[model samples]
Target: MTSIPNVTLNNGIEMPQLGFGVFQVPDDETTAAVATALEAGYRSIDTAAIYGNERGVGRAIAESGIARDELFVTTKLWNEDQGHDATLAAFDASLDKLGLDYVDLYLIHWPAPARDRYLDTWRAFEKILGEGRVRAIGVSNFQVAHLERLMENTGVTPAVNQVELHPGLQQEELRAFHERHGIATEAWSPLAQGAVLGDQAVADLAARYGVSPAQVVLRWHLQIGNIVIPKSVTPERVRQNLDVFGFELTDEDLRSLAALDRGLRTGPDPDTFN
Candidate 1:
């Protein structure tokens, strides 16, 4: 089993740096896929209400025999659930689907800036945290301006900000802002949906390190201090994703990977998305 390292969030919560993501994973396959990830030594699992697999995730956790305290589970509030009242109701629904008394972390899945209700949503998150319904609260796809406004309005800092991040879309500015605010930057689609696996630079690094291109890319994310969740339905790949801790990428290799950033994103723009 690979020993995954933990990153402490601003609120003093320790989350596994490497986690298994369930994005785009079909509902029917989520349970088995999540089970494979757990069996492969992944203690952290990231899912959401919009993902439509929280029930399957709950089923896997219920059957995995792993104690609740030993696992870190995360879910999110959807765009339609952006106001304080709706956010609380949505969280309750998510929890009902997840069959958990409390989640390790909860997030606003997207800023949906146009709706302009994220502030209200965040207030609910703060209340949930205060009530001990969640260990930590955060946001996703939040840009610098959104985070700043959120902090200003609510006077509470998000523990994390998850976004589409990979070698191709480094999000340097947002990442720096997160660093300055003591918030952890977590990477969704960390592999860029396999877009970077065939890159010449990553291929070369993989060859040198005797690892797969996916491993090289995941290692790069870790070296750069990004909490990354690489999802895979294949059992072998699930195990393979957790096998990145054994090797180290050199400074030169890190630079080469950094140079691959093209500022491209595989998901919606946070500022514009509703």
Candidate 2:
């Protein structure tokens, strides 16, 4: 098994820079997917309450017989559960469903800025950490404005901000802001939902490196110092995604992909939605 590198969080927790994500993966399919990822040597698992597959993830980990400490399990608090107390209540529910004593990471699923609840939601995360029920806390789909609001209101910066980052939607400004703070940037939809997998630039780079385009994409994220959790139900792709550690991208190659940024965001804009 190839070892994926780790990045230390501001809080002094060590996190794997790459992991497996289970978004839109149904409950029935999650077990096999997670099991395959585990068998493929992935140590981290990212899931969510909204994903409705936490039970399957917990079952896979329990059956895999890997020590809980050896595995990094992460889940999130949904929009409806966004206040301090409600978020805490939601954590109990997620834990009940996940069948675990604790989670390695817990995040506020979205800022829900319109609802104005993330401030309290982050407080709940702080509580979770104080209780040692969660090792680290973060946010997802949060932009710079949302992060600034969170920091100003709560005085706690997230350990990671998982967002939609592909070549098309580089989110360079937001990433720079994350770097300015102690927060680590994590890439969701790291393949741009396969949007860039067929691009000529990625294809040429893949050919040059003797790797798949997906590996090139993952490599780009790692080279930029972003944590990535690429999702795949296929076992071969599951194994292939983690096989990105052997190769590296050059500065020129990195600049070329950076040029492909069209400011195209595939997911809904959190600001407009809320």
On TM-score, the leading prediction is: 1
TM-score of each: 0.99, 0.98
Give Cα-based local distance difference scores for all models: 0.94, 0.91
lDDT of candidate 1 vs native?
A: 0.94
Q: What is the lDDT of residue 262 in candidate 2?
A: 89
lDDT per residue as tens, model 2, 1-274: 7798888987998899999999999999899999999999999999999999999998898889888888888898889889889998999999998899999889888888889988878887898899999989999999888888889878567999999998988888998898889899998999989998898999999999999999999999999999999999999999999999888899999998998898777788888665
- After superposition, which runs of candidate 2 have C-alpha atoms over 4 Å from their true positions? none
How far in Å is the alpha carbon of 131 misplaced in model 1? Answer: 0.4
Model 2 lDDT at residue 108:
86
> What lDDT score goes with residue 194 in model 2?
91
Candidate 1 TM-score to native: 0.99
Clashing pairs in 1: none
